[model samples]
Target: MTTIAVTAPHAPSYYAASGLPQPARPALAGAVQADVCIVGGGYTGLSSALHLAEAGFKVVLLEASQVGWGASGRNGGQLVHSYSRDLDVIEARHGAAVARSLGSMAFEGAAIIRERIERYGIDCHFRPGSMFAALNERQVRQLEHHQALWQRHGHRELELLDAAQTARHIGSGRYKASLLDRSAGHVHPLRLAQGEAMAFESLGGVIHEASPVVRIERGDPAVVHTAAGQVRARFVIVAGNAYLGGLEPQLSGRSMPCGTQVIATEPLGERFPELMPTGHCVEDSNFLLDYFRLSADRRLLYGGGVIYGARDPAHIESIIRPKLERTFPQLRGVRIDYAWTGNFLLTLSRLPQVGRLAPNVYYSQGCSGHGVTFTHLIGRVLSEVIRGQAGRFDAFAGLPHLPFPGGRLLRVPFTALGAVYYDLRDRLGL
Candidate 1:
């Protein structure tokens, strides 16, 4: 694994500058015994620890850095439903039976987030409504099919808007139309992650920040070792995602770490509502899409673009500012207050990889860019599996995962070339 300095702070993003104050957690020192051991402090690990602790299991969670310090704290905060690949693609690849099952759980993750906020009184800025802005007739047709597919699967909260209607709602003339999912929403992602960790601690779960697991000994009771401590538990879950480098060779080859950048503009003041009249979160329909939403304090949190192998650029703003200006030319001179970069585990099929390595060693990763809501679902399902209920967990594990082509050395460059082809297609409106 890439060794993280113990004193590393949260990324200098808007999330770190203005979210709720997170509690300080100590590093793991002495050996501990628990029913379950979890690695990573992001949404997946924190949610797993919270759910497991609520199920009356002794849980210990270890993080290389502070809670929500990774992509969990650095996402665009769109609480979107479903997987990266929609149900139609899933049905085409797998079978209708599998698609039906996945479709049923598509909205469950968003619902879980709502319930947790109410149950725990989390202070994350929760907002309703998410829309996919269509730039052309082809995109509009896709949204039409998307709305119909979700409606068929019992998601009736979607409403398709014509070009005029879309312009009125979002106050942007760029889109031909949009599909609004009132059930989908946005939030202060970092706060939600930290709040989940706080809730877990309240339930007697133990957390050790800055304690990265270096090795895992697979046995009856798994032994997870850190530099200064070790956890002996009946079950172990690896939720490190993109940051989990070189840990488990058998499970790591199927996905690649892809980088993305985000920029938060200085408070938009009165211009915020003019850009988005309905105050809903907006994501484009392009394969490489732009997702933006207004923060509670009225700042625009915009994120887009991707790079395989996750080589972060030195000046994030230099690259992303032009993308933002192209989307909203009205905000051409708007000053960006913060910019940060993070990576998500991307799979070849653009679907998550969930399965058990050993009987007692489980993992869930490769949510692609759709990790915000799905991580919560995976966490709950993981807890269910550890508690003798494996139906939901098995459903996801059954999904096929293929390794990235070109092996480790060539996969990055190969994916970069593939991205170029896709970008051209997007530019040509294909």
Candidate 2:
């Protein structure tokens, strides 16, 4: 297993570059005992803490870095209703009643975000508007099918836009059609994660930053080994998704860390309206997706490009810049102010992994770039699971996950080969 310590913080990205200056959060210093110890302080861990703490469980959250320092801090920020996989897959795999229940929960995830933001008074620059842009005829057909599927599920917030209508909304002629979900929106992800952490701490949860869990000794009372200190808790939840390395080899094997990059352009002022005229989060239908949205301050926040291995900002910028240029040729000379990359876990089924590693050790991961809202819902569902009500949690927990073939050494190469075939099919419109 690859267990190199990642201490050196990369240069500030768009989220860090624009966010309010945060005080240096200290690392774990002394031993602690709690009813539950969370291994990562991202959205999943914080969400779990908020619910568990509210339910009167003593909670301690350990972060390898600062809160929201992982993908939770650095994502495309689209809070959509479903995973990358089609809904029919769930219906086919599970019974219709179970699939419908899970489907309702999927949409409920969006409501959870809205309720949390309003209840907590979190100002994360949230705006409602998300478009699934279809650039070709085949994609347009797929969107139509999805529209029907969602409408049948009584999710009527979706409205389909024709090529002309999509062009009017996006100010770009690239899209053949689009499905707009007004309830789903975008936000400053880092701010959202940080706000949730604040809420959790306000509820009497203990959070320790820069505290990486080195080992886990599972039993009636689990002990987590950190570099500086240790945590003994009745329950342990590992919420570190893609960035989680040797911490849980079995969980890591179910998914691989794939790198995705995003770039933020300087404030475009009047030109911002010309870029994304409708103020909607936009993503194309290609398998290797291109997603963009307007910043709260009216800058173009564009994200695209997927790399198999770890690379630096310069390399990420090189791969993504041209993709941005392709979308808006008019903004060719627009300088990118900040560019960075984050890792997201991808499962073969493309759904989240939610289950118990042991009776007391639970985990939820593999969001496939759709975790922003679902992770929060999973956290609440997990709290319910801990309370001995496991209906919703089991919808995902029942799904099986295969370890990547050839383990760590050859998984990347094998997945890269599969990704290449998918990329080619996407290009050929297969």
For all candidates in order, the CA lDDT equals: 0.89, 0.83
Residue 230 in model 2: lDDT: 82
TM-score of each: 0.97, 0.95
Give the alpha carbon lDDT tens digit for every residue of 33-59 in model 1: 999999999999988898899889999
Question: Candidate 1 has which clashing residue pairs, if any?
Answer: none
Quality of model 2 by C-alpha lDDT: 0.83
RMSD of candidate 1 to the truth, in angstroms, is 2.0
**TM-score of model 2 (CA atoms):** 0.95
In the range 154-259, model 2's lDDT, one tens digit per residue, is 7899999999899888878888899999989999999888888887877888888877888988998999888777889999999998878879989987787778
**Lowest-lDDT window of 10 residues in candidate 2?**
2-11
Q: How close to the true structure is residue 149 of candidate 1, measured as C-alpha lDDT?
A: 90
lDDT of 1 at 269: 82
Candidate 1 local lDDT, residue 82: 96
Clashes of 1: 0
